[model samples]
Target: MVQKYQSPVRVYKFPFEMVMAAYEKRFPTCPLIPVFLGSEVLSESASADGSTHVIERSCKLSVDAPRLLKKIAGVECVFFIQKNTLSWRDRTLLIEAHNETFASRVTVLETCSYSVHPDNESWTCFEQCASLDIKSFFGFENTVEKIAMKQYTANIKRGKEVIEYYLSELMSEGITEIPRWVPPAERSSPSKAASPPAAPSSEMPAAALAHQSPRLQMVSWGPDKLDADYIERYLGRLTPMQESCLIQLRGWLQETHKVKIPKDEHILRFLRARDFHIEKAKEMLCQSLTWRKQFQVDYILETWKPPSGLEEYYAGGWHHHDREGRPLYVLRLGQMDTKGLVKALGEEALLRQVLSINEEGQKRCEENTKIFGRPITSWTCLVDLEGLNMRHLWRPGVKALLRIIEVVEANYPETLGRLLIVRAPRVFPVLWTLVSPFINENTRQKFLVYSGNNYQGSGGLIDYIDKEIIPDFLGGDCLCQVPEGGQVPKSYYLTEELENLDHIRLWAETIYQSAQVSKGAPHEIMIEIVESSSVITWDFDILKGDMVFNIFHSKRTPQAVKREVSSSVPAVNNEQLIDRSWVLGVDYSIVESPLTCREGESIQGSHITRWPGIYILQWRACGPTHARVDEVLSSLQGSAPKCKVMYYTEVLASHDFRGSMTSLESCHSRFSQISVTTTSSSQSQDGSLISR
Candidate 1:
């Protein structure tokens, strides 16, 4: 494996010309860097106008390694080739270097640059990147790799110091500044010839220019900018390649997605998530951007409002900072009634609250970054699962939990720095087993679970959290403000009428479809499942009358059979299913038994496919009052009973859903005073087998 290192940009409060002059003093030999033995120029060239200079040299350095390893390698000093390109007019210097001693067994390459700051012409900026690739190292590849990385990082940190040392030496000798290069044509020849050499004055060095005899205003950096100094001071250090990835990705977004570009920290997280793979990070970032736009999630913090009941029973709130300065969130999952919360506030409301929490987390991260004087992009969540029981594992509640997880993992990748689960009861494992598959592996790795009093000792909560801020309920000094998760009163639930309005609002604001299924001709949706073992989840609610739902599979592909266009409704015409040439047993079979759904009752379910083929979901209206021929005739002629269904379906790959929550399907329904039943048909052995 190859190892790489990147250094954050460092700034010098001096002119580029003066910095370059100081940089040159380090060549030949430097006592400060004992490893840098010396360098001899191999070739040198200058532009016609003397504005650009290029120099190449053969450099030698003493390898700092264990004596035994050095003896095994039979080498004491390593050679490297260095190339320097200086553009005097542009005030920039580029340096490239590569190792020569281990040309065949190992390869090390490094690049560095010094240039004038973009916003301040007087200041200079320096950046560096290096990589080491070792193919064979006499069975000590790991040792060599580690040694190489340590050396590289050490050199990077000392680089800025070495330059500063040279600058100080020059200031001590009164060579505080160097005149800028000027072409012969640009100089005033007569005035230059008549000018007299002035005597040097005993003045303070340029470093003290910002202060007067007493004192003046300090040269403080503005918060809005992310220059070299700002990055080194606030954001954590990044490797050169990592910096390159950030710069390139940010540039790409600026060119392609000008208006909705994400913050630099946001982009950096994605790059880290993919180990700085530029293309993979870019792709993931773009998808997240699209998801955010489609769902209008960017404004969730400003738009979403939690129901009143949730505030008192949610059992979650922001707490004090963790050991690493990450914002802390305390969630008392055990005390809170998951099922009750879902009942009082619909799935959408619950999801919105979660999103709002995430948005607020992002905001808090920014504030903490300033307060803590470091980058703190992700928050730590301490989940208290002491009272967790089987009720928290209700299927609907679990499904809701999975849905929220999926959406968060997609949009808020890497926002969770750590997850501390305390007092995890026995039932917690069951819940973990059910929802862990839906969580990202990277996220799962962050979870730290504790069974009981074990969390109070070494290698527990105290390792990451300060004991002073620990909740009093958990044997700490501070009193926590988070609610105690409790059962929400059933009476607080809205009436059926108001609940129906919420469901209607969901359908009205989304792309999900609503279709009316009449008697005799059932409404069927055909989906082509190309892979077997995948999950197909469906959620639908009967808005008006009752209906029957059934799923069937067919190996034979359906041919396009067009019929007279209906002016009222358009649907796929599948009348050919009854053709004599089509065999029910061999071509198609019912995969699920007909299930009756009453009006006002929401239904959500999933099926695992056993075979790769096309599947059909059908819904038909069926009223219960068909006792005799007279009643049947009257019902058929009166209004041709119809059922309204609003539904959404999704197909997810098995691997994606493994150890993670699959996409959940949920519905909201309110029924009137109508009873319904599915029509009974002859039970076929094939249908029974498929259904099983």
Candidate 2:
């Protein structure tokens, strides 16, 4: 975005970022020798009644902006930047000028510091422009900028290694540096490489720069005048180069994320964001990235398989996890489980079930109600919830949570003053498990339930409710009372069941889960087997980190590199299953022009530039190639842009080595042809099949 100078503007932007942004804006794709003066935040101070801040004594390089501007204009050159190292206060004007006769033209500074106040002084000082030495400022600033650019260039070399290694592993083709990186002395000069100046006129067509919203000021980029948000999305808005880099780094995501930048983008958005603000460098990677699996994640709470008996307890019932699914946030209802607790808070069924009453089973679930004055809709899907820990940024710790709340209020105004808490037993377990895969390990272990209240402690929401009243909430005893199996005994019904409390609760929540689809990560996937529906859930995530997260999410189909290893492959033991099937994902990845291979002692430049060789596939639903599907995938791997294979079914929690690769693959296939659809629940089945 550019600014139309109503006046030959001499304004300096704050937050110290405009220095670089200003140059880029004014020059726009033109090669300019950007000179840096000093490392400091230069704030133009203001008198109490001032309309604008002046270049004050507090500024690092104190030359007045107006005087600096006139000098460059007098030179009759199109120099994009001017900076100073000393104030006109020293009876000297520190100044530097770019000789725009050529791009990266032969340049030098004309220092004019005369009666220089010593560097260390106790008093405020100001020397007029005519009485000051300005050339020295240019010299010092240029030297610093050159040194910094050199360091930055060196770091880029180091980064190249990572990109090359991954890319060479796949494409095997040599990665080369872009020609502009070399210094003029070492590089082919303009005679060899065209470093021509870009069009100076802003009257160029919108397409010449890029499409812009009518509201966006696109004439020039004045760092001072530009909002921070505008700066953030500015780079994204740039065409060709930006879009091209996206295709390389993001691959298939280009269609959906075609850079719909927001208005008034953040000027310093990249500082605390990914890569420490090295976005300029990252965009120029040489190779495609490599990812372990074709990671598939759907945003929107979809997979609607609610825990047995809890489906009816939610607001949205068990809407299949989909982009448009309505939300159903689970609230773990809890209270103390002591004998007398039920008599007070629990219903009569408490006396019959297990001689005990639990709020999870006793309480009536109010579907999508504004209970506690909060609007929360828990979406249900038959998802295989591994886990969720708020420790991850999304569901962070209390401190982070508080910050999130504040952000919500500040950014999402409508959500302000709303207290969001989950206060239901069935709700808490799902919330914890859903967020588990994304959080840190410690956070995963400490995953807390959404019990809706503000009291704090270690246990799940039940623990919070337990202390509040004989809270009819819940846990297992500390004795070595391990169930027959070592896992948490989710199969046992420990709540009051006599008065049909469990049955009633089930009927209510099932109706709730049947509500709507949400546009969030699908939390569950369920398939029916007779009257019982088996549920599997998927967690959605966009890795916001460099390297690990980047590669993990990038995908490349094996369309270019097919292998015949699925069949003729022996069955896998539990451990092998972890690595070969679920871990490796049944599909194969492609190694591009540069064949992925083992390295030798001799050095080869094949891994020269690419960061990684990953290619993302935009797939909606898919699963591993079944034994029958295997033959099809094998034949089509390198032929089709995409291939869907079929596999036999196997029990996969433990071992798939029983010669039933079909069954094993079934357990871990990309998609089980998984209906993930709602069906007539077995609430009316003969046996009480629901697990409390």
Candidate 3:
């Protein structure tokens, strides 16, 4: 595999002419760059008016590598051919280099440029890109690549300091600036008539500087013009490699995507999500971009409008700034009727509302970045869950919330800077249990949950938000305009016909599967739980009939049912299911109490798995049944049992599931697309489930 690097445009607070003079001082022999032994001029050229000068040299550099590798390569030094084109008229210097040593086994190409900043004439901009390809390194390709990249990154860092060193040296010598080259005819008469300075004894032959290359036109960057200053000011400070990833990904999007590329802040989120792995981040970003375009999400904020019902009853709105100037959003979730809202507007409307909030949040982040004179790319949310209870734990509503959380987490990584859950009630645990698996661990770490008067003390909301800006309900002075969340009347719910129409939209956004369970034949999902204390979560709706939901753990594996891995969820595979013949209590035991869900009711809950074994999630028709499977199977031949359900299940580890974000496969509705693996640290796991 070939490796590549591209640096963001770096700005120097000096004129291009002055910078170029500093740059020239490093050539031939510079003690500042010890590895750069020396260079022999292969060729040199200049424009007729002396506005352009081109020099080609064969450079020799000491190889910074292990003695064993050096002995194998049979060389202590490496040779490279460098080409430098200096355009005095345009105030630009372009350098291209390629290695000559080990040409048959490896190839390295680098390009560097120093030019006048487009928007500022007094400053210079520098950009660098390089690629290393090892075609046939004998048994050391990976080691060689790692060493090469480390060296390249180190050199890049030193390159800046080297230029600064030369710049300072020139300033000390009173050669702070050099006059820009001009045509002879344009020069003043006295200057033109002045005697020409004698060339240095070490200067290259004049004949070598006779040839001319074409004028070097600076390639304009894309529509989303990003510069060093802009990146630092708005996108925060990224490491050199991270900056390269952002630039490369943005350039790829600009080339392939016709629509407006996401802003730097948006791109940075995806980059951070993938931990600055350029290719991985690019893959994720492309998917998100496609999703945005497919859904016309760019126009969501402009096209979406809240219904009067939501405007009056929804418990969330933008409040004042947080202590860090993050746009503050207050959500009184416990007091709000999530079930009522879902019934009235259906899942689709609520989803759109959530997306709109995210969009507004991004805009607010940008506004605050300027207002605070720093990067503020995400918002802080204050969730007051004082009145949360069983009523809020409506199954379908919880499912809707999980679906929304999934969508937001996927498309809006790193958007929630902090979460302040104050006045958290006992029922909050139930709600958290159902939803926390879908939340990123990074985001979860930002959660500051406060119960009762715990938030009024020293380590509470005041630490994050100013006391004066706290909402009135929280016993603060501010009169928050956010609605006082209340239950929406059942009468306001849309007709069943309207809800069905909205379900189509909701279905497309989720990764759930549906299955029908008959009385004699229960639909059982077999999950191989390899980690004790992990949480098994489920969300299901009794679409056509009543059903009983039960969770069981069996020492005996069930029959191997081929697991159908879905594409959207990456990590699933066709693994063998646990074997059958597992007797209750003897080989298997019920871990959760059986809950009978009525027809048209939605259910969401989770269980803490106590043992590492095959766990079965079974949904059966809610009615009288035989005591044994043989008795139930024996009666199935005479009559057909009817029942149906749609459910989704997820196996969440108590600790962080290493590579789970990149590898896990998931689905929605009946069969969950969760593909949990058992390879992770136990200390990072959160085993409990909660709902509010």
Candidate 4:
């Protein structure tokens, strides 16, 4: 402890612990410089630099030595305590006294690197330690309490004085350089070097939020140290796998409806790991939209809801990282909270999280007689009619479904309508009910008959495929008849069937180019005819999850060929009706939490998916919300450009596949959509591969 000095500008020293403690109590909200003991920027490996010769690394910095001292004399606004709770009146005298003697050439830097002013007792020790060249430094310790009766009065006084000192210094030099400390830039602040820059607020509404993608806000902390602050910034480029995943999502919902899109920010797209980092995956997503729409943004939306109290944000803060982080970069989506909803919905109806519909699914719990008779569901009845296209009808269907839920739920226990999950025909929800009970489930299958079909001329097609899709080889229909119960003629090509035959079709290099053109049939995935009309057979099971389509034509009769195959293979429910309940233009889901791919181990069943191939569609959410739908479309794009139907279902839990074993390449020739030989892991209990 230093003795009282006679001169003005007194200096004092206090324990670092005492300093921090006083500051927290004094300036709770005000940003104050930390007067830490032996505090220096940590090395990349978190190692301490041997800069501190005084404070020991064990408890705090060396008390008397240079443990916390890097400069001989640098001014800093740090917690100054004479020692062990000195009175404020005494501190004033000490500060005044110190300015008069024993020091020279002081350079006051930005923040306090170390407690800047040490009193005489500490000064003597510092001088002696340096003069005596004491490497194994030893000094007396003092338990001190740094106290400040008035809070912001202390830190604010310091900050203001520092500003005044700088302004005066500039005037003395007859020079002018704008000081960086002041808020001259703007209202928003930049995040850490590793974080996405937060966008500033816009003067207008949806001004910035309308055009920003949601992807910018997502910040992925690596599972290990490898994605550390320094490494990820440079090395984490989009991998090929990530690029492919993106390519698929870009095309998945080229025709989704806007109504089905989630209005809630959190429920939008996801930041996926394992398969590919969401950011890397989005690179391709952005380029995908460039091919379709002339106007597009570079960034996507990313939001993070910190565990309460960590971040000063609710529903988290929405900011766009790619679009020059500005208020113009933020996109706002409605927030959803389930807690207050049930009451607002009125107790007359039941609250449902999801709903399912199918012929068998309609009988889940006997309707009109069950406890909650006729459970509140999304649809009055799942419609299985013939109508518009899946690509075009998807959004309209969602709007219709939401409207149906809102309209009918008025009197019954179905008034609360928050979400609607769509799938082709009635199977999705039927498949949905057994898995999810909180949602509306229809066990008694019933659908309103819809005469929505307008396609009369060329089978189910509405018109000549758009110019964007018109194929080169297979336009004009050839009037050729096949014998009843015979195979389809070889001349008839089904592009979707071959391309999306299985996930392996992803191997086809030409697939990415599909975004620009429509398809006819797979010339690559074909079975040739022989001297004698040979029966080259393939079952629909191979193409069950319609990710790919199976278009086949034989010299003989497709009718005869199909009849023979029908006797041997049970048909998967491939979409037949045009009015099936599929979203066309817009489809989206609310992602309530960070999707846990790890928790997916509980699902025992693997539901059948007709769409075997995955495709992606990307669009800017509302505006500045950088949202790209990582949607899975019928990998059949190269197969059936005009097909009005598409379907998909995730059968196995993510862990079931040690790694994605989708033979997307061999999909063309093999009739099997799923390889029976491929095991979920090197060793699996179920031999889960679908046996053909």
TM-score for each model: 0.58, 0.22, 0.66, 0.17
Per-residue alpha-carbon lDDT of candidate 3 for residues 147-197, written as tens digits (9 for 90 to 100) = 766666656656778789988999999886666666677768854543221
| Candidate 3 weakest lDDT stretch, 10 residues | 205-214
Residue by residue across 154-269, what tens digits does model 1's lDDT show?
Answer: 45556678789988988999987677767757777846632211211111111111000111112112123245555545557775446556766666665444445788888888
Off by over 4 Å in 4: 1-40, 43-564, 572-692
Error of 3 at 628 (Å): 54
Judged by lDDT, which candidate is best? 3
lDDT of 2 by residue, 1-692 (tens): 11111111112211111121121233222222122212222333433322222221111111112345326424322221233332212222233222222123222221111122243232111211110011222333344333323332332223223323433332333322112112335445666753312211110011111011011121221222222123223322322222222222232222212222111112112111222323432321110010101110011023222333222221111111112122212222122222222222233222121111111111111222223332222222111111223222223223323432332222211111111243333445554455444443422332332433333345433332233321222222212111111112233334445324643542233211111111111111111122121111221112121110000112322222123344654222100001123223334331112111111100011001112223221111123312233443343333323211111111112122344323322342221121122122312211111000
| C-alpha lDDT (0 to 100) for residue 175 of candidate 1 | 87
Q: Name the weakest run of 10 consecutive residues (lDDT summed) in model 2.
A: 599-608
Q: Whose TM-score is greatest here?
A: 3
Q: TM-score for model 2?
A: 0.22
Angstrom error at residue 503, model 1: 8.5
